[model samples]
Target: MSEHKPVPGHRADYRHFHAIQTRWMDNDVYGHVNNVVYYSWFDTAVNHYLVASGVLDIERSPVIGLVIETRCNYFASVAFPDQVDVGVRVAHVGRSSVRYEIGIFKEGEDSAAAQGHFVHVYVDRESRRPVDIPEAMRMALAAIAVG
Candidate 1:
């Protein structure tokens, strides 16, 4: 049972997508995917976009993104071997933070299996202090941002 609210029309706001296949280990005794797995999907979806954009250098970038907040709401159950469509969009972008909204849908389904958000605050790699988001990074994030 998901404990979060579903944002209407959020599905349409996502401009980027990632495909994630459920694995056997993801299932619990009740025969459904565990709640924690949805969080992983949130990470997978957001990071996939960042990596694809080439603005985030995970290995040696001068700046790094740190997760500050997260939440999810499950509307349906998912099983092993079932592919999921992860829709992503930026709900907000700040000088030093970005809030990514993600909807996890069953493949070919109109609605989401789960919906949630993950917020990342950019910081200095060395100092680990918060810093303004770079122009390039901000632009990349905006490409998928919804109003």
Candidate 2:
């Protein structure tokens, strides 16, 4: 097996943040939160930001973001009842797609326990065709764009 290198991310690296509470069911047989739960957290954090920013309206929006790709790297284990602070940043924004980088940190910790990214392609909800990001959405994305 090959050794994996951890992607280091600090709280200061992100421009936005969202807090997630872990439930008792989040823990698996191994006594730590399951790996799959991390992905859910990622989705929650990003969509929440978009909705709160008035860029995404799940039910009424003509333009919607569809996740096309996702990846994650885990460096530590977290159990139930632990609050997670998710750091969010836009790594890249294309004409119809945006790459969102996220860092999951244990509450009050400085460094991320896990880090990953998801790419979302903006598309028309009805036609399912790629659409250019709206100007307002573009501006919102720029606010979180990272180097």
Best by lDDT: 2
Alpha-carbon TM-score of each model against the true structure: 0.92, 0.96
For residue 146, model 2's alpha carbon misses the true position, in angstroms, by: 0.6
Residue-level lDDT of model 2, residues 8-39, one tens digit each, is 78999999999999999999999999999999
Model 2, TM vs. native: 0.96
Query: What lDDT does each candidate get?
Result: 0.87, 0.94
Clashes of 2: 0
Clashing pairs in 1: none
Regions of candidate 1 where Cα sits further than 4 Å from its true position: 1-10
Worst 10 residues of 1 by lDDT: 4-13
Question: How far off is residue 90 in model 2, in Å?
Answer: 0.1
lDDT of 1 by residue, 79-145 (tens): 8889998999998998899999889888888888788898999999999999999898898998998
